[model samples]
Structures are given as C-alpha cells and as structure tokens.
Target: MRFALSAFAALSLSSAAFANTLESSAGALNITPMVTGLDAPWAVDFVPDGGFLVTERDGDLIYIADGTATRVAGVPDVAARGQGGLLDVTVAQDFAQTREIFLTYAKPQSRGAGTALTVARFSEDGTALENSREIFEAAPGFSGGRHFGSRVVEAQDGTLFVTIGDRGNRPSAQDRSNHNGAVVRINRDGSVPDDNPFVGQSNVQPEIWSYGHRNPQGAGLDLEGRLWTSEHGAQGGDEVNLVQRGANFGWPVISYGEHYGGGRIGEGTEKAGMEQPAYYWDPSMAPSGLMVYSGALWPEWRGDIFVGSLKFDYISRLDGGGVTEVEQIEGDATSRVRDIVEASDGSIWFVSVGDGAIYRITPG
Candidate 1:
C-alpha cells in the first residue's frame, strides 16, 4: 500500500503578496510562489493534467496539485550524496495516452554511484508509479560524490537523450568505453539506436551520441528542434553548447577557463576536431536547467534561451542563437535556481533550491 506523504503546504502567493518585481531587459517580470518548503528540490516537470512532478535531491519525488504536495511512490533508490541523487524528470510526449515518464538518478554501484536512466508508468490516480524499470546506467561508477550530469530530453523522433558527467575524472570524458561525460541516445526500452554515431564501433559505448562534456546539468530542444546543453566549467568556463552527433567537446583538452587556482587548462581554447561552445561565461555562474522559449505569452522572447543559475540567484536569458546573454531575470525569489522550464500556457516556471520553493514568472 502506497502512502501520500505531505511534503509541504502549497503556498500559492497572490500577486499582491509577491512584492519583488523581477529585473529584466524586456520588462519588469512578476514572480509568484507556487509551492514552498521543499527540501533541496532539483528538477520539476508539468503533468499533462495540470499538476507538477518535482524531484528532490535527497531521493524524494513530490507531486503538487491543487495546493497539496504528495510524495509519489515507486521512485528507485538513489545514491543521494554530493551532487548525486534523484536528478531530472520528464513526461513522455504522449503522456495523456501512455502515462509514461522518464527519470535520471544516481544509481548506487559497487564502486560508488553513477548516473542512470529509468522509465515508468504513472498510475491513473497519480499517486504511484505502476511499472518501473531501469533503462541505462553510466559505466564504472566512481567513488567520490561529485559531477553527475543527469538530464533527459526527448528528441523529435521519440528517442531519449540522456546526459552524464565525467564523475570528477577528467580523462573519462575522452574515453569511448564508458558513458561518462557523454550524451547518449537510446530507445524507450534502453536499446541503443542503430543510427547512433558510435553504434557498431569497436571499443565504444554504442549509445553515445556525443562526448567530452564536463558536467552538463541542463539540456533542452529549441524551436527548430535543435538540442542545446548548459555546462559547468572548472572555475570560470561555464558554457552553452549546441550538442552535435559524435562531436567531441573539448573539456580537459581545451577550455576557455583555467584551473581553479588559476593556470592554463589545455593547449588553447581552439583545437582541431573539438567543437566550440556557442556561448560561455568567463566567471562561472554554475548554470543548471535550460529551456528554449516558444514566445507563446511573450512574442519577443520566441526562440530565446533561459538558463537557471545555481551559483548566482537569477535566470540568464540568452539570445535566440544561444550566443549571447541578453538578459538576467533576477529578484528576491530568484534564489539558487536549479531548474527552469516553459509551461504549456507559456508561463515560465523554475525551481529554487535556496528558497525551497517553486516560482512562476510572468510579464509584469
């Protein structure tokens, strides 16, 4: 028997109660609190029927509806340590008909823990997960508890794109034998797509779509269906990149930023065969969740990109091409934004780990 654990009282703040107006280049943005008192919430995605599925890094999945936050059952055990834990959640494209969802977590392993992907069906009542299964696990789980790049994005063709971090092992990003620091494309059942770049290649993980990322915590598709990732640099090289097929993104090899204590990182910023970042931050902001806007509510923002900042308490709005930081949506509520997404109604929603709440942003 599953239980409905009350995570917190959903504090739906009225417009008058939300005092701080967000600073933005476009205009003053209004932010309202939707839910409060969450415990280290990491990611959030909308349910097809007008609710939210939120993942807490401490291994809890909470569902908020009509001012009540209930804990959902059947989430897999996660290695909730350091940056590892229940990471990301996304509903299926045909969620109303299929009731399917995808989750990424830090799966406990013999060595330590590794990022993993799972597929499950939500119950009709939204109280429990009916069928749960692990689809993929990044190889050779390292011991230390840092750098688990675990974001899931559904491609246009219904395939899944899962991201993994280097697990603090810089050299692993260049290794073909493991899934570390790589983007993998796989089928619904965890099968490798035959057309994947590394498929059929010797000594390579067949599921890899791209490699050499440092720690891509956020990923999303643009209006044209192009995939983009927001990655963290060691000290200052935080970047946004257009992920490509089998392309090598220079990590330890070449970086625009230097070492933490200040030293040249690689041969140089530009290198042969390695892909360059679309945009980068010289002073790392620790970017997390990513979303490409459709401009349904704000026509001017169509095709623009929104990125949540974990280190800085704000959302960085990038230009349509993902090449420039055009705006910084900041306010009192914009505290340690861990995830950001565009809702069905065109309103922007984000998860704030620092505030322990979920906030909705709209044009003021």
Candidate 2:
C-alpha cells in the first residue's frame, strides 16, 4: 500500500502540474509542454528561422527543428557518464550569416576520466558539423563528475563569456592560475581579450574575467548589455549575480549554505574582497537556466529574472532587490530543467534534463 500510494502521488502531481496558468496583473501566462520524449536534454538554443537546437546529454547528439532528433555526425566522443557529456549550446550572434554555433561538453580522455568543460564551434549542414573546431578547454581537468559550469554568452562587441565550474573542488575556485571556477572572456577567434582581468598576470590564464564560482549553469545578458549568472550552490546557497569584470565571487571561502550533511561550508558568508550575491536561496532551488524577461506576455515581469528550478521543480520570478515570486509550473517537478531561452516571438522555452522535453510559457 505504501508503494502504491507513492506511485499514485507521483502520477497525480505530474498530471496536475504539467500544464499551468498564471494570471497576474500584467497578463496571463500559459505554460504548455511543447515537445516531449527527449532523453536528458541539456540545453536549448534558438535558431534564427524559428527553430531550435537542443542537446541531449546521455544521447550525445544535437536535436534540431521541432521534436526531430538528428545526430550531428561530427560531434566529438564524450564521457557521457555521471554529470558529464553534451551540455550547453548557443547560437552565435551572427549565426544567420555564418551558420556558426557554440557547444559545451565533457571531453573524454584516458582511463575513463575526463575534463568537464570544452567549447567548440560548428556549422549547421543538417547532418554533420562543418569546420568544427574546439575553441576552449578547461585546464587540469578535475577527477569528479559534478559541477561543469558550462554556459556561453556572446556580447555585442563579439566577445564570448564562458563560465567554468569548480569541479566540486572548492579550493580550486580561488586559484587564479586555473580555468576552473572562472568566467572567461575571449574573442570570437578564441583569443583572450586585452581587457580581461588577468591578461598580464604571470600565472593566470589571460582569458579569465572573473573568478571564484561554483557551478554557474545559467548566463545571459540584459537589455543594458550587462551579464548575469545563476549558479548552483552546495545545499542552499544558490545565487544570482551580476557579472562584473575582475570581480571575485567567493565560493568555498564564503557560502550561505551549509554542507550537505548540515555543517557550515566555509569560514563565513561574507568576505571583504569578494562580491556579494544579488540574490540567494537558503534551501536551494537548484537553479539551472536563467533569462531576463522583456516580453509582452507578462509586461510586469519585464526586466525581471526568470530562473528554472531543478530540485524544487518550479520557475522563480525574481525582481530587483532580491524579491522573488515563485510559480509552481506543471511538469517541472518530475523534470530537471536544464536551460531556458526566450524566443524572438516573445515565448519562453525551457528544456528538461530528465526526459529532454521542450516547454513553452506564453500568455494565456
């Protein structure tokens, strides 16, 4: 009877929340499941012509256009085990003209061990990657399976910002010489920008823009061209931060969350030189994808941050000064949301890490 009750509860929750409606002062939000049957979709990127490129982690392929899952033939072999494999995907700023797309994944090395972060560019030809080349790779890859910190954003000046995870090694976040736990800025041609924080530092990687981060899975630019990131914390210190150049975002050194077993994570929650988070969740919403909503579907939500929660299974609406309004969306409770992107037509699209379904939230 206990097992039966648990199963019934799961079914009821899944059925009730898979479709949701939000009636707010600005307007109504109708969230609908767009496409389903994906196997651990990791990221979703919008194409110029109203289609999308979706990455499936365990499957090691990029799915394109509607629910059609096509294996891009030239994708490199990935160590698709335990928090690794194909991750984030983003279209280049000049994607329409160049057909260039950026991808992040865990590149497999010897002994079944692998580095968690690598970025590459490929051209879209419907079947295989054309002129694909790796542009960035994490140095001294860690041994564990968690915290890849893979998100790519292109600035208006043609600079790329790539977030790297701390690889579950807290102390590595404070090391300026490594690529792990840092946000790196580079030109489209994979050259470090002169203005990068550590461009002239002796031991530091010139590409590093900012350092001391955990797992920054979500990154996007706002209307003002300022970069923003949402990162996963140990247990409760999930954070939303405004990315600033040369900023030190304290990770293991300072965290609001306790360790997984309920002990303090670091020395304190505040340090002198590190930048404080704009917002943090005590119980950890396990935030993944982030987007600043400027669409007409919910005018009041304009300039607000929309974050997808993986563990809590909801979408959090965050406003200025850390005020948050959480809406329990349907289907997310059973699905781990990997990424969220706003379409050019003002619709919000989200992908699940569990089954790789694509969902859209629009005005009802």
Candidate 3:
C-alpha cells in the first residue's frame, strides 16, 4: 500500500526524475528523496530512534520507519478545510521518558474552526498514538478558511509556543482579548504559565506570548533560545520576526507590503510602540517552516536561519543574525517547499507540497 524509496536508490535517480543536485554557496548538495507518495504533507519531525513522523493536511499521521510509511491512529479530528487542517508535529522534549508528542491543527469549533494544540503519546510499537488530548485552542474560532498559523515549537524551558494567525481578521491581531493573530505559550498540560506576558491581566488572554501578526506559518528557536517567526504578507510584505515577550508586531496597522491590489497598508509601515521585522521580503517569497541550524553538518553555516518558500519553490538561508538573506537553495526537487528540518545526523530534510514527498539534503 506504500512505496518507500531508500536513500541509496534515491541518490541513483536520474535528473529526469527530480533535481538531484543543487549548488549553494556552501557547496554542491545532493537532494535525495527520503519518502514519496505523501498527500500534501505539511510538517516533518524525527523521532528519537531511526524513524520520523509526518502530518498530512488531510489529517493522517504517518510514521516513516526503515523507509516505510505507516498510518498511525489516534489523530484528533481536524477541520480539514481550505488552509485549515493538520499542520505541525513536534516530538516532545522529554519524549524518551514520556513518549509524548505535540501537534497543531485547525480544530473544529462551534463558530467554525480555530488553531489548536494537542498532546498525544506515541505507543511503544510506534504504530499508533494513545491518550490523545487537546491542550489549547485559539479563541473565537473564525469561519474563514485562511490564515491558521499553527506551528508548534518546544522552548528551551520545555514550554510549548504555538503561533496563531490573524485568521484574516486584521483588527484582531491587536486585540488582546482573543488568541487570534497571536503567538501563545502554555504548559504541556494546557495551563497558563504564571510568568506569561499577559497573565493576571483582567481582560487579556494569558496564553498570548506576542500579538499583531498576519499569517505566521513558520516558527523556531535560535541557538540562544530566542523565538523567531516567518509571516505572510498580502502582496509583498512577508516577514521574519524575532519574537519577544509581550511585543506587538504591527500587522494590518503597518506592513511593508500593500494590500492585494496596489494600496497603502497601515500608517506607511512604521508605527509607534510596534516592533519592526528582523527581515522582510518585499515581493513575497511566501515563507513557511523555519529552522535554526546548529551547523551539525556544516559548521560554516551555524546559527543561520533556514526558511522554505512556498511561492518561490526554494529554501532561503538567512544569516547575519537572521536579518539578511545570504543564499537561496533552489532546485526542481524543492517544489513548493513546505517545511524544513534538520535530522540528528545533520542532514537537512524538507517537505515539498508540489511533489507530495519529502527530500533530504546533504553535502555532496
């Protein structure tokens, strides 16, 4: 029922099959297919052992072991509508001891659907998930099918940081009363951390770590444990932000890009008390899936930020402390790059929506 291509076999595939090699500033890279036959895979995360987990937007959690794909049971029901579905999957920090994993998806709700976080246990046999539990759900679910920024990141302190988009509602990003257009922080048990930015506030949602964002689809932590996010702009204002506690990222109120049609957006891009982006793409690269490289394989590229571009079909390597675009790794295999992650062995892996498969990159 599944086709699994081994790495050795993938390396032997001719250029006619896929882009076999890419030339980056670092060197020539061999792009090999790690797994194929995925249906709109959104995110990929490695397990402690030799296997990995992948989430399909259609709501299947597939575990890839020894080059085979097996559907794992116990995934929570997802909205599975336009732009809303199974999103990101992350292995828990204490996975070895707790066997826990985290997932972010568009959860069905009364008003419509909202981004939600769920905790589940990966059974010992790695074929099924057990004890699945919904931990957090963004507030005031919207009916729109766009902008569910649901990337899950495990912070250094073991807390989970989940990004929520503006849900196509501009003003809500600035409103603290709801989780819309916000990056929320919560404990694994779904409880608000006492030190959260808005905690104890009378009207604010305590889970919000930061607010005022459009559709931030990518998020990660740097070597220093600082949080960062990649966001989509309307026409040309995509952004990469260095997330901070209680900081307000001016979304609709200020943007480097204009609306869909040519028109000004938000006070000409600068506003008082609003944080500016670390880096932005004026022509809209449509960035998604962020990763802070440890340089495990390429020491020279340590501390660089790698982001997949859905619009450009390439991987962007940002350096100069995440404020500059140093290199663009592009190839036919990088079609509609959705998510990019580093494996334990230092190989870089990414999901391709256009190809409906996963590929790994290594120094050639």
In model 1, how many backbone clashes occur?
A: 0
The residue-level lDDT of candidate 2 at 237 comes to: 90
Candidate 2, residue 342: lDDT: 88
Superposition error at 338 for model 1 (Å): 0.7
Give each model's whole-structure lDDT: 0.89, 0.75, 0.90
Model 1, span 1-364: residue lDDT tens: 3333333432444545743576677688778777777789999999989799999999988887876667888999999999999999999999989999999999999999999999999887778887899999888658789889979999999999998889999999999899888999999899998899988889999999999999999999998898999999998999999999999998889998889888998887989999999999989999999999999989899999999999989899998853699888887888999999989999999999998888888888
The stretch of ten residues in a row with the least summed lDDT in candidate 2 is 1-10
Candidate 3: which pairs clash?
none
Residue 280 of candidate 1: its Cα lDDT? Answer: 96
As for TM-score, the candidate ahead, 1 or 3, is 1
* Error at 328, model 3, angstroms: 0.7
Model 2, 318: alpha-carbon shift in Å?
0.4
Candidate 1 error regions (>4 Å): 1-16
- What TM value does model 2 have? 0.88
Clashing pairs in 1: none
Per-candidate clash tally: 0, 4, 0
Clash pairs for candidate 2: 17-330, 17-331, 18-330, 38-355
Ranking by lDDT: 3, 1, 2
